[model samples]
Target: MSRQEFLVDIVIALPSDLPPERRAELVAAESARARELRAAGSIQRIWRRPGQTANVGVWVAESATELHDLISSLPLFPWMSVRVGALARHPLEDDHQ
Candidate 1:
């Protein structure tokens, strides 16, 4: 079977009672992981949700199961309240390309 690509949108929120030091560690680790994923071409883009302790990104994966694995690998996964969405390509975007 052919592997299909998916676009995943994620939001991460840390617990208010979480320790600052732990937060720092998680952030650093998360950044490193994102870099690795980017290099591997699984992560396309990432941005911080301005004025909030959250982030959003576009990720490409073969399947939702693979995407879940990727997200769960994050160091902050345990502490995060996350929302994920699958995206479909727009006709306009294809025309533009």
Candidate 2:
């Protein structure tokens, strides 16, 4: 049995009025969780948007259900507004080699 790998693009938004200390705590926890996912090969890369509180990330999972589970497990999940997009390899890119 082969597991299909999916590329997921994620955008994360946090509430603007959250307390500074709480935000710090959440950031710390989220970073730790992200590290775990990276080590497990679930998360590929993450970047913070310039001049914004949002973040963008690339993730890989065997299925959408597994991806949802991973996102929902983040410590900051409760406070985040997230958007996810599934990506497919483009034919042009595939043929570039």
Candidate 3:
């Protein structure tokens, strides 16, 4: 099946009582996994909201189920509050070439 696009907004809220070292470890692993997804084309674009623990990204997957699986693969998924929207091709973006 052809891939579909999804827009994702995520806020990572680790408990304030969580140990700093554990937070660091999860962050490190999350970064590595995100890189892998990007290389694999699952992550199309990503941006961080400055001065916040949040990010927005465009992702590609075969289906919403696939998208969920991909996002859940992140090491910090359990600590994330996320929103995802399916994206549709813009009429102005038609490729006739």
Candidate 4:
């Protein structure tokens, strides 16, 4: 089976009013999903930045469409906005290609 990889950058705003335990629960739930995907060989790598408000998950899938679908299915916070983009190309102001 052929697998495609993508760098997924997720940005979310942490709720200031939420308790520490609740925040931990939310992280646990997200980690559970990561485990599920990893077990299925769908996730290649996952990384969380410290003192940052975003998550970066590198995923391996069969196609770009599948990746989009996966991101759409995530249970994100109600006030959060997600931005999914293909990460193959470099984002630069100069045309180096």
Which 10 residues in a row give candidate 4 its minimum summed lDDT? 77-86
Candidate 1 vs candidate 4: the TM-score winner is: 1
As for model 2, its CA RMSD to the true structure in angstroms is 2.5
**Residue 40 in candidate 2 has what lDDT?**
90
The segments of candidate 1 whose C-alpha lies over 4 angstroms from its true place after superposition are 1-7
Per-candidate TM-scores read: 0.78, 0.76, 0.93, 0.61
Output the TM-score of candidate 1: 0.78
Please report how far candidate 2 places residue 92 from its true position, in Å.
1.4
Q: What is the C-alpha lDDT profile of model 3 across 8-89, one tens digit per residue? A: 9999988999899998899899999999999999999999999999999999999999999999999999989999999987
By TM-score, is 1 or 2 better?
Answer: 1
Tens-place lDDT digits, model 1, residues 1-97: 4344554545666878978998888889988998888899888877777877677778888888888898889887886666667777678998897
Whose lDDT is greatest here? 3
Report model 4's TM-score to 2 decimal places.
0.61
How much lDDT does each candidate structure score?
0.77, 0.77, 0.95, 0.70
> Which regions in candidate 3 have their CA more than 4 angstroms from the true location?
95-97
Give candidate 4 regions above 4 Å deviation. Answer: 14-25, 77-97
Q: Residue 34 in model 4: shift from native, Å? A: 1.7
Residue 65's lDDT within candidate 1 is: 84
